[model samples]
Target: MEFWLRVTRSQITKEIRAGRTDTWAAFALVVRLFREAMRKRAAGDERLWGDLLRYAQDVVDRTPGA
Candidate 1:
């Protein structure tokens, strides 16, 4: 979870730093990575998954043009 969060933050930061006007693609990458991780592992914790998704959504909502 921490790894995914860090990756998301890094991706978002990178996109913003590069002066990109759109960040949905970066967020999509994070979501895809998280989903892949969930598929490969047991990923039975619904609470953790919800928290991560909510966090991602909040970030997206706060970001401009995301």
Candidate 2:
């Protein structure tokens, strides 16, 4: 989980630094990634899913003008 969070943060930061300011696009990307992770997990682990959601939310919240 820590590793995934770090990777997600890095990706988001890179996108923002590249001037990809479309919040909706970023949101969609996060959602897609979340779904992919969920599929890979597929173990009925709510805690993991919740943590991932929280991390994604944190990124979105920290985004400028998001």
What CA RMSD would you report for each candidate?
9.8, 10.7
* Candidate 2 whole-model C-alpha lDDT, 0 to 1: 0.77
What would the per-residue lDDT of candidate 1 be over residues 4-60, giving only the tens digit for each residue?
688878978888889884787767876797786576456565665666778879999
State TM-scores per candidate.
0.38, 0.37
Checking candidate 1 for backbone clashes, the offending pairs are none
Residue range 9-29, candidate 2, lDDT tens digits: 787788888988684487788
In candidate 1, what residue range of length 10 has the lowest lDDT sum? 39-48
Sequence-dependent TM-score of model 1 = 0.38
Residue 48 Cα positional deviation in candidate 1, in Å, after optimal superposition: 1.3
The residue ranges of model 2 lying beyond 4 angstroms of the native Cα positions read 1-36, 40-42
Off by over 4 Å in 1: 1-43
